[model samples]
Target chain A: MRRSALVVDDSRVVRKAARRMLEGFGFSVREAEDGEQALIACRAEALPNVVLLDWNMPVMDGITFLRAARAEFGADRPPIVLCTTESEFSRIVEALQAGAQEYIMKPFDATILGGKLAQIGLLDAAEVPA
Target chain B: MSGSSPDTFAAIAGLVKARAGIVLTPDKGYMLDTRLAAILRRGNFASLAALAQALRDPRGEPLVRDVVEALTTNESSFFRDGKPFEHVKRILPALHAARPAGARLRIWSAACSTGQEAYSLALLLADQLPALAGRQVDILGTDLSREVVERAREGVFSQFEVQRGLPVQMLVKHFIQEGGKWRIKPALRAMCRFEERNLLGEHRGLGGFDLIFCRNVLIYFDTPTKAKVLAALAAQLAPDGALYLGGAETVLGLTDRLVPLPGERGVYGPAPALARSA
Candidate 1:
């Protein structure tokens, strides 16, 4: 089965870029413009195995969504990767502490993104195309 | 604010730094209050001052340890950043080529919380290094917390745990869906081992490693502790091996035993001293 991912960001370009990147890596991608929409989508459908969350979204920020998701799903929540431009080390630490499984700084290459997914055991070697 | 005293806070801070090499800031007073409130209430202490007195007593040894554990952050997950594993994959063939016949290749995931980091490496090795399928490859994961180690050994994860950094097909292939949780497949689980070992304590008999990922764990240590741990890690590194630290961490001024390898960001090579000696 093709793995599914929910790409949540405020920017259309980022969402489109991430969707393309995830699809190229064999993921069936879903898009949300903001954290509020992402949360609604999560509760409305079968949750995606992973969520690529953006930190600075309007209406609901990544941190608020993270807390809410943890509350809703408890320990069963999907893995959330915070996709942000925040380069401060303290903020990265804060995100990890707040239950983000991983943090990927913005402007990431697709190959690097695949490797991150693979490192977390999300991408099996057999699954990747030759 | 009942019973809070500067002396008590100072003593606790000193002990924590001495034991774990963490620097406790004044701002952490809130953290102390929040974490230690339960213990204070249980002991019938009305103030931090009373709790401090108890901590000074001979019977407070275990309490101190608990306080340290409570304050010490152990946040982590498998395959923390994506690029490092990409680097691992790119370098694996060369690493395999350099190995001597019959020599076992080992990898260590220091501060491996809940086993994700170590298991991630094992899965990657199993998938990419075909020659290692039946070979003796040791993947060891160690953490300072017994609680986290126990969780890692179980090889069970909540949907959330498996979701983070995990892809769908791999989830289906490498993990078994059991109720609301996911369990790692036996074949993948068998490739890795987990233990509880303090980075500051005596070195466990972990044999030499081809790659050592001592990532975010080192950021907590002060300079002296970081230097000591780096030296110890270097001692267990193969001459041509690599070490991966957190993105924010570097060995530049800490030790000359680890020289940065070009084209590999956040990775350091064994110092020339060890390379020449080997």
Candidate 2:
């Protein structure tokens, strides 16, 4: 099945690039500029299968959004993949504990991203890793 | 309750029920106080009475709507439960078999908060219905709130949104990492549309749907409103079509036009009478 994803970040360039990459892999993409916008967008559409979220943003940050969304969406919440530059093991554990399903560091290779996507089950095995 | 009078409580309760269809009891005064206290503070009112006075003013109609909207929770997620999609899997094959060649297959998600439920359905169809891959399949989602509808159209979600109920495999297949968020690809999104629609109002323009999912929304309505919404849904459903409600909801006592589909507990089929009538 073709999967749909919601990419939340503050940077337009990042949103565009990610959109391109996902589309290249045959997945559909949606964008949000910040956490509040992302929360509103998430509520506005049919829920995407996965969410690519940034840690920091204006208005509402990633962690706060995660807590609220987890409480609101309950067991049906999407599998969250944290896309951030924070690589410290403590930070990763904090994110995982805060409800992130997976973590992808910044400046990641497209192939590595694809591998991570595949590892998470958003892509099929035959598809080349990002 | 300190300075609040019973008369003020009655008036506020009446307004809530009339405007938002929320049936508040006298015992819920504390809830009323808590929910509206912020409004009072924002308006610079000293007490709930002052807030109620403003609410009763014709000028405060918008404020009333805002209050109700604020109080009405918009809690939702994508792929809420795993089983509904499983049922969708079974129904798709049957729907394809029942449909004529090249005919469009349509699904409407009423009260599609954000777009999770609708997209979840789209993913299921795309994955399971290969014959339908290139066919004309319209997955339309509608909600009463304009803000929610606008967000649904944008289709952006956070890490938390992605983690709710989605499987990791679906995530990898469907999403791309951008910054710290994941955005749905356009192709998957292309199959669906979102609109602002109030189920209690007229649905003349929305064409007949092969499957209508009004999950988890009816619990907010009173029995009469539920009956009205169900009747409207029955009118929009095609013969042999199905309806899915929240696990806690049922049409058994509320309406005769929807009979529980065998083997699927929450799934209901249109009553024979409605089928023949339609």
Candidate 3:
């Protein structure tokens, strides 16, 4: 099955970039404007297989959404990868502690994004690592 | 090099592979033609045929050196991949555990063009491993291009170059804003040294390293060349050293002399037998 992804970021540009990269890697991608909406999307009948989250967002930030989704989705919660700028590195450790599986900094290209997805095992090991 | 015969081009391509291990296929003839033209003009040769024949002369070292430099890929960037740097940060504690007390730490950025990646490490080590401030840390960047090696040695980057992959804080902290370029602070530049080298040839007795970043250079080599290069790297790596390949490159099919670290993308360690013997 093609894995599904949810990209939650206040910026449409980042969400679109994430969506394009995720979709190219064989994920059915959905976008949410903020953590609050991402939680709503997670509760849908078909949950995403992974989430490409942004650390900062309006209404609620990525860490809050990660905690809420982990509480509500429990075991069904897909791997969350926090995306942020270089300055927000401290929050990367925080996000990982809060159940995020991995992370990628901003200004990423398709190759870097694919490598991160492969590291999380959301993509095939053989195809993606190369 | 312009309007050269196919035989001359083939001979030049074969010579490049033997000299530098950079395989240029017949499809790359136009690229060779374009790059080699400058060498001819610089040498004031009438045609590439004269240059090619001179390459056969016993005193061809300088001419061959120029050819290799022109063929070497000097393209690189700062923090080429964020993941590997993150992986290094995660592994630092482990690396510390593996090393003895107060031992020097060394990192080799193989084929490091213009020293961006090596200096990037210097900056990272300065920030991430503050405790190592007392310990000796050396970052060596090597390339085949004399022009780029000189640039790396100078430790200067233009505004556009510094903006790529370098954060604002790092830009301000580690660099002096010259007229339109950023010069790496002397302290940072002191941690690094640049040399001209051919990966296929001897390293001139360069010693073992704790971490070797030979990223993105293997894609150009043929299978046999890749295997030879990997084996050579394994020999120079400390028993506990890590070898980093490009995201698109791996040791799985190329050679078993190195094995990929489990759960670590683009990181590998010397094979168990190799590590044990070392």
Candidate 4:
């Protein structure tokens, strides 16, 4: 029962950082540079258990991917969490309305990321290796 | 301290246990260097050795209090561990039905660091139990630290704090966003009150509670202290009321006054034998 994640962001640095953290939390992670690539990954491979999405990316942004993913794959699976610099309440409300399961502000460390994963029930089976 | 000896750690541990009743095992000596670094800078003690040496005097109660406060970890989040809250939501209807008409259902959040546990309950009652309106519920959040109590009373949380363990929808519904922060709305704030009260200090003045949450606080105490605190908390619970402990904690050997509430982990009620005797 290996849990997998899809990390979608324009910056390789952020994807690498999130990949390292998610890997530490026992998630097998895959990277997608933008939303179109993420959708291709979703369609070609099995849906990930969770998606760490970045907003404002070039070519299909996160919200577009979210809506499209919901329309095609369904809204509930592969629980999407919006991870970006967007701290605006309106943006958060919009993300949740668009079908994101949770929201994480940028500059989050391992603890914040881990807590959000746990909150969404993604970390239930994957215990962080001591 | 890199230069300090184990005796310095031993001395500080002794002082903390004597003053605050918190057991600091030798393995946790590493925590002193980190947790006390700020106090060392503020007090200009040069090193933990100097602080431990200064604590040798009997009249250093204020400094001892500061050290104790710093050493006590305040790690908490909204709806932490999640299960106890689910159980609370499930049992609330039956508990309310058992009460007399219009009687207030009181809940005590002991050691309510930064007030998340108490405020989480308030949010749950407001969101889940619409039939029981505002005035019918009373949530009391108490802690040993005055600083945290004041912070809890303010009902303000940083973005980082609000993000942890809080559902996105609840955050939108119950909190108002300030610049870079969120404040629990007045409606939710009005349902709860925060106080600086110690579990070991006194309890006669605090009235009985229909549900008590003394989670994660008792783990820092030694066995005898754990038994004592359990007895005292049990004293404040109504006969049929529920008491929730941390998932890692139990009353197995601590006290006979509390027995596990059926079908839930870390939940306890007054021992039927003890309740009947009373």
Candidate 5:
């Protein structure tokens, strides 16, 4: 079974970089520019196994999307990870309270991404091929 | 001098093995290169060869110690493996109940690099074990690296370190932000102490512990060293205590001093035979 991910970030560079990394991890990667598109994509297509969301966006924000998604699809399915440059401790707590499974600071590489995924049970740290 | 020449690698590897009981093979040459680069830069050594030569000198005792410490420093994170922590949480109350009235509980985080494992135990007690209120609980974190022990003593962590394995809610609850870094709250900090102690050396001064966490450390040792360390750990462990090894480590061929605790992963209890004999 192929794992799937929906990356919701306004920056095409970030989405592309994340896609490349996720694809390398054997995940089928999808992209949306903002939270609204990501939510629509979730409803229209099959829900992704995980979501990598950015906080600041044009149409919708990560926290809003997280709340709406949790309410609609249920709280625990398709683990949502907030991948943003928000280093504020309060923001992290807020995202977690709003149902984000994990939080990542931006400027992340494959190692950091893989570690966060492992924390959320998306990947096994020991089994990841070097 | 700094290139990965076989001689330099051999010299450094041999020193580490002799001093720290850590076996380093050719495959870990890259680790030596990466870890030793800082020492070279700090000492202004021209290369790894220069560092290796310096380590050979009788006056290079400090350099040799630093090299060993650098190689032996283990990567750690809070609640590193979720399962072991969960298992500890579930069993702790029962263990507490078994204790005599008002008896203090002590936990050891052996080979505790950067103190995350020790502090994680403190957070567990602070967050979930309200039953332990008014009871004295001590968590001791020991490692071979003086630098890491000092860092652990400070209870300060960079943003990157805190973000690694800690959950957002727990981070908010337990840490205070200080100039873009996080410091473990004073109350929680008081629950644990940090010391520079070698796992391969004497542990007689450290008394019995109700729970011991020596995770991800024995993998670096050879079979003999592992057996010795396990025996030492068993001696310090209380009769009803639990020992947590790394997820990948096992005691099957190592020693008869410990046997796997039933229904738990990566957890062990003193062997029944050893217990009976003792």
Candidate 6:
């Protein structure tokens, strides 16, 4: 089965890039301008397998969405991977505490996104390209 | 493993300096045993004494190369320090503007261990300078160690090696994980070339470079050796070329051939005569 992902970020460029890379890796990716849309997508009947959550976003930032998701969805929520920059170390720690499965630095490449998927067992190691 | 006497250590250090410019102090003698253990065992030398004696022979040239490779430190990573790379990204547009239309850019990563620094430069160029996508941007990675040169050519790195300095995105896009190691894909590897070279020796054919990264490795040399190496590097740089060094390194009180870029610590451009002329 093809996995699905929700890419939550304020930047249209980041969303487009992430969507392309996810599609390349055989994942159906949905973009959200901010955390509000991410929460809505997650609560939808067909929940994504993963969420690539950017720390900074307009209309409910990523952390708020994470906390909200955990509160509403409980442990049945999809694995959330925090997208952050080196300067956001404290935010990353907080995100992890709030139930993020993994984190990757900003300006991320497909290799890193793929690694995160494999890390959380969303992408099988055997399915990875040689 | 047999104990290496003080004389044995000194002799080994001398041989290493003669082949490669790296200076080994008496205090660093302890490091030889740990670093050169593989060489000693592989070469079937009974002790450091035997290796030293063998180095005295004319046929020991190849062995000397191996010894030099063994002694030199190959510790490196992709964008090891973030500051220099940040500077590279910021200065690149200006550097490009200063040159003639469609001018080719040549970058040198001196003592580039396993080619991480050179590859990092390539990645940055690819990401930032979309204008130069079809231009000739050659990144040369040279080291005194043959093993690392070969390894750099192979573009394979372990998980722990990739974990340092490299962001996860770059790791995934530029490399392919094969079992336990990650090998750089052809696209990234194509932007770089690796070679075994002694910085203290002649390198005329390589010609001048537009940017040079001689970071971190120079601290291994003594003051005099550092000056000589800096002079050589200055000679190899294009008139407007920029040089990046480690945070701990400086050209002040060493040589005036290169001057620091204003407000850009650890980055140097050639002195005014050459830089201003260009």
lDDT of 6 by residue, B20-102 (tens): 77788888877788887888898898988887898889987888887888788888867665668888888777777777777
Winner on DockQ (4 vs 6):
4
TM-score of each: 0.67, 0.65, 0.67, 0.91, 0.88, 0.69
Candidate 1 lDDT, B62-89, residue by residue in tens: 8777767766777665556667888888
Candidates ranked by DockQ: 4, 5, 1, 3, 6, 2
Each candidate: chain B TM-score = 0.89, 0.88, 0.92, 0.93, 0.94, 0.93
Off by over 4 Å in 5: A1-4, A20-27, A46-49, A67-79, A97-99, A109-130, B1-8, B47-49, B273-278
Query: Which parts of model 2 are misplaced by more than 4 Å?
Result: A1-130, B1-5, B27-46, B274-278
Instruction: Give a tens-digit lDDT track for model 5, residues B6-57.
Output: 9989999999988888999898889887888899899999988888889989
- Candidates sorted by lDDT, descending order? 4, 5, 6, 3, 1, 2
Give me the overall lDDT of model 3.
0.79
| Regions of model 6 farther than 4 Å from truth | A1-130, B131-133, B274-278
Report the C-alpha lDDT of model 3 over B144-220, residue by residue, as the tens digit: 77889899999999755665556544766688876656799999999998998878877639988889999989998
Q: Is model 4 an incorrect, acceptable, medium or high docking prediction?
A: medium
Task: For residues B154-207, write the lDDT of model 2, one tens digit per residue.
Answer: 877776566555554466667665655667778778888999877778886887
Residue B208's lDDT within candidate 1 is 84
Query: For each candidate, what is the lDDT?
Result: 0.78, 0.76, 0.79, 0.88, 0.87, 0.81
Which of the two candidates, 1 or 3, achieves a greater lDDT against the reference?
3
In CAPRI terms, where does candidate 1 land?
incorrect
